[model samples]
Target: MAALIDAIDVKRKTTFELEGVPYYCLDADISSPTARGGQTLVRLRMRNMLTRAVFDKTFKASDKFKEPDLQTIPATYLYSDGDGSYFLDQESFETLQLGEAMVDDALELMVEGLAIQIDLFNGNPIGLTLPAQVELAVRSTEPGVKGDTASGGVTKAAVMETGLEIRVPFFIKEGERLKVTTETREFAGRA
Candidate 1:
């Protein structure tokens, strides 16, 4: 049987179908009645899971949206070819090619052989779910200025194995592995 959902139960980071199109629920908000007799409404900010188009919408409590038919498959990150990132699905052994725009900056947090979640909508690759943190090897960075103390408030720019640059404490050096936050692309700490 097909899945159905009430608008009130919709949550962020999940996809729900409305008007027969699947949308990623980025955020949901409920409005308090301004006047004593005013009707309450719910607002949603959503992105088209396939086309990447985003928009805001208002809905009533009784609105029904189909739960998106999605499957989460485990995949291993392969290599990138400048224009796209590739992944090998564990179950099917099929390579999924996602364009740079679709992959966005998430690739920075992924390295070869990393386990990742691929979201398939109607059996087509739609998006990814990444871990909160990843460990990346530092490729290069300027030598810390002489005498920068461990407790001092100074940071140096370092390039990672994935070619993304981020500021790290002066104590960081080339050839070290550091944990990075996937969402903000910031240095977390040594791995």
Candidate 2:
């Protein structure tokens, strides 16, 4: 049996030789935060070896990862007509369509030909991560009433370029750029 030791036994930034292979100790922890749709969810925080960027992401523990080498591909949004989503791989120039289940609420924020980064596992697309903030055109909304600012920050419904209606501060008008929270579809502020 291989020797087992507490994860803390390794010193930070210290390299160790194991089985003729050199390895650096990295701090990481996995936790099942919650269960959704009958899947065990896990959150992980890791640093990118190349960029040194710290990233935290959640995933289903049941999903098998072949290796730590996860690939990020630039894909252009082809189209999504409420049924499914399609994209074009910029490097391979191949077209791939993902089911609605895979795309999830991301379909609500997509604009045709929009470039997004997709994470792939074993050549299969797993999840999509979008920009923190995206400027979208407001398609429709009620005209702001004069003196409406007196209210205690009440919001009104506004439709976006994607036809998804969300509540925004009364000052927002049609055709204006508004920043939205991609997760909750809430209005962050006027762009």
lDDT of each: 0.87, 0.66
Candidate 1 Cα outliers beyond 4 Å, as residue runs: 32-39
| Model 2 CA deviation exceeding 4 Å by range | 1-69
Worst 10 residues of 1 by lDDT: 144-153
Clashing residue pairs in all predictions, respectively, total 0, 0
Candidate 2 C-alpha lDDT tens digits along 1-191: 23333333333443333233233335434454465656445444544332234555454555433223346899888997666788998999998777776677787788887788876644777556677766688999998888888876878899999888899888887899888888778898888
- lDDT (10s digit) by residue, model 1, range 34-64: 7997767789999998888999999876788
Residue 13, candidate 1: alpha-carbon lDDT: 84
Q: What is the C-alpha RMSD of each candidate to the true structure, in Å?
A: 2.3, 11.4
Please state the error at residue 121 of candidate 1 in Å.
0.4
What are the TM-scores, per candidate, against the unseen true structure?
0.87, 0.61
